[model samples]
Target: MKILITGGAGFVGQALRRALGNAHTLTILDTAPAPADLGPSTRWIEASILDEAALREAFAGQQAVFHLAAALGVRACQEREDIVEQVNVGGMRAVIAAAVATPSVEHLLFTSSSEIYGDGEPGQIFREQDEPAPRSAYARSKIASEELMAAAAASPEGARLSYTVFRLFNAYGPGQRADFVIPAFCRAALQGEAPVVHGDGLQTRTFTFIDDIAAAMVSALDARAPAKAAGSLEVFNLVSEETLTIASLAQLVCLSAGERPRVLHRDHEDPAVGRSKRFEVTRRVADNRKARAALGFRPTTPLSEGVRRTLDSVRAGSGAAEARG
Candidate 1:
């Protein structure tokens, strides 16, 4: 199969590339320069998703499309909602238009965030059918994009396009940017700095490993098409069973690095801290039973083991850079 992945240079994109291996002819479309080590079966297109011409060109002759490009991160999106809307929503519109026009494209996979669940009460599990309570700009953008995907699939022009939406939970692992919680904690622990805990440190999230995310994404390619003759739209909650508090996650990272757990609690809205946004979701845990039954998705990594591996990878990467220098 020939696959075209938007934002293929990102953290999750690189992981998916590894999972794809040499099985598929891969084309990566991103603004970033192509990775020096990309496989022979892979080619890179340096462009933005908002470029309709570029999207059409990339979608040409492709059997599948993985739409991963977007303006990510809560704080970043909050600060620049306009850009978020432009990239997230506008990009999806462009991708759909291109896919609808393309003849060879069969399936399109979209990565939606679990942040759309908003602030759920403790023990409240988010299901696929649950109404979205998006609190932030980024979350709202994702929900909007999701609606666009469904609408596009049901459109007459998109009758042949099959689409899948994977509502991804907090995905953390090596190569994740430091702005994220897990990698931030790991970096602080490795640098001998106290991990910063925003708010009360009780905000909960279901952290899925990057490998599991990649595997589930790759498995979707083999999934059966929707029975509907016009088109098909499927939504699955892609997450692991592990749920942990922010403070607890910090402690786990410290322990993984063989360091004492010393955390620095700060107001999420504090400008001095200059990271987290004012509005933060209290709890977000998704029910993955539908995904388990439909896609045979079972996340295998435990929180402790995943944390250890992430820390080790960071250390190894730093050591390799030092050696090269």
Candidate 2:
């Protein structure tokens, strides 16, 4: 299939490339420059998601599009609220329009975040049916984007839209940015510095490996697998059952990096200064049964192994961009 991935140069996007590049003709539509080693079948187009002409050009002859472009990360969203709505919300609209306008386009798989279910209690379980409590502008923008796609499909442009929403929990692996928890812990461990834990160290999250995330995404391409609701619109949580506390992950990273992890607990008055994203949830565990039955979505990589791999990759690419991946 011919495919286009917005924000295709970023970490998760790169993972998708590694997963699906061999089988499909891939075109990357992103404002960022192309990566060094995009294969022969893959091409890069320098454009933002907000550009309709650019998106239309890229969407041409494409059978599917993975909408990964956005103001990523909680901090970036919190810091840039005005632009987040413009990009996250407006960008989805542009992508949908481009897809609808294009004759060949059939499927669109959006990579939404777990942050859409914000402010859950400690060890709280999250399901797709839960009402979204978006605490930040970022999560709210994602909610709006999901709604936009659903509403658009129910409209006149209903037939060609094969839309799926994946609410991805904490995905960690090689080439992750330092702003993320795994990379930060690994970097601190490598440098023998104290890793900071925002709020209580007991806060837990399910961290799925980047490779597993990519695999789940690739499997989502099987249009027969997703829910047959609303004429094939599906929403699934892409996450692992492996849950760990923030402090525990830090300690694991330290051990993996050959250092004894000393976790420093800090409760700050300003949430922006804290490592935790502003108004973020304390715990989020995904229900992956739907993904497993629908898309054969399974994450096999162990957390300890994933941490080791991330540490090695980060150490090798220390001078690269921060908080990306």
Candidate 3:
């Protein structure tokens, strides 16, 4: 199958390319330059999702399109609401306009985030059926994009679109930006610095490894995959079980990196910067029963193992970065 991965040079995009690149004809679309070390067989198209002409050309003769392009994180969206909305929400509108109309596009997998769940009900395993209560601009943008996909589902080309939305939980692994928790903690641990914690370190989240997320996406792309056509528009929560606290998580990263745990807790919630406003989800956990029953999605990587691999990657990356510097 011929696949086009938007944001193909991103952390998740690179991991997806590695997971599915060998088996399929892979084309990467992004504004950033293609990674220098990408495989020779991989095709790279440097362009933005907002480019209608480029979308028209890229969507032609594509079997599957992984729509992963978006503003990076909650903090980023908070800092640049206007630009992030255009990129996160508006980009979806543009992609749907271009992709759904393309006859060759059978399946378009969109990467949504669990942020849409917001500060969910007090004690509920966030299920697909639960009402979405978006808390921040980032979370709201995610829901907005999902609604756009829903709109496309009712459009004239709905049948041809075959859109799939995977609402991801906290995804982390190597190549992830250092701003994220795992990498940040890893860098701090490696440097023997006390990593700064955003809150009181009580908030919980389900962190899925990049490889597992890529594997799930690969499975979802398969036409005969068990997860296909569960509904006209399908949404799955891609995550692992929540098994650690932010404080524990910092310690775990230190342990993974073979360092002493000396985490510094702080409240980086600055209203002026909109950091607290954007990251409103105090605790995030999901129920994967729907995914398991339909997609046969079973996450295999344990936290300890995932952290070890991430630490290894962080170490390598920091070393390479230092060498370059």
Candidate 4:
């Protein structure tokens, strides 16, 4: 397949590039260029997703376009709401429009977020059928983008475009930004600094491995699934069934680093943080059954193993700490 991936410099994009390099003709478009060591088979184009002309040019001759570019990171999104909205929602609109305009683009895979199910009622595993109740600005923006993509796919112009929207949940592994929980904890613990545990550290999350996510994306691309049927959009939640609390993860980080650091909760005056959270992921876990039947999708990496691999990568890329502010 001739594939075009946006945000190809980002963690997930890098993983996909490595996984699909030999099997497909890949063209990556992003606001920044990829690393110098990127494979020869992968072509890089530096362009913003909001640039419709650039996106159109990138979409030309592409069989599938993975729309992964977006303003990400909880801290970044919380600080820059306008920029996040513009780049995430507006940029997604541009990508969908460009795909609709290009006849050869058969599939457009959009990476959505599990944040849309924000703070569900206790013990409710976020199912695909639940109505979205977004809490943060970032979550709202993602919901808007998902709606936009669904609308575009239902239009006459988008009749031929195949859409696969995956609502990914807490994907972690090497190459993840330092601002993220896993990488932040790994970097701090590796540097002999105490891993910062925000609030009381009881917030829970499901951390999916980057490799499993890439594999799921490939499966979705190759599956015979309809983007929408019966006036509703088809969506899949890509996440691990395993759940871990922030405190537990911090302890694990300390263990992985061969050091036990004291957990320091932020001061009450430092803005209230770490709201207790969980997602009703029941249907999401069940949807894997559908993926398995249709696409032969299966998550192979366990959390402990994935964390060990992430720690190893952090050790190898210790220079990343210098890049941190």
RMSD of each: 1.6, 3.1, 2.4, 3.8
Q: What do the candidate models score in CA lDDT, each in turn?
A: 0.88, 0.84, 0.81, 0.77
In model 1, the Cα lDDT at residue 259 comes to 94
Q: What is the lDDT of residue 108 in candidate 4?
A: 80
Q: After superposition, how far is residue 24 of candidate 3 from its true place, in Å?
A: 0.8
Please give, for residues 1-325, the per-residue lDDT of candidate 4 as tens digits: 8899999888888888877858888989998967788776778889998877788778999988888998986556877999998999889888888887877888888888887876745566776677887767788888998889789768877867767778888899987876787888888888787877766677677788999988888876667333433233467877777787777887788788887855656633355543222312222222355555655666788988888888888887886656783
Q: Candidate 1: what lDDT?
A: 0.88
Q: How much RMSD separates candidate 4 from the native structure?
A: 3.8
Query: Residue by residue across 33-116, what tens digits does model 1's lDDT show?
Result: 997887889989999998777877899999889999999888779999999999999999999888888888888899999988
Instruction: Please list all clashing residue pairs in model 1, or write none if there are none.
Output: none
Better of 1 and 3 by lDDT: 1
Question: What are the clashing pairs of model 2?
Answer: 11-325
Please give, for residues 8-79, the per-residue lDDT of candidate 2 as tens digits.
988899899999958899999999887787689998999998887888789989988899999987767888
Clashes of 1: 0
TM-score of model number 4: 0.88
Lowest-scoring 10 consecutive residues by lDDT in candidate 2?
A: 223-232
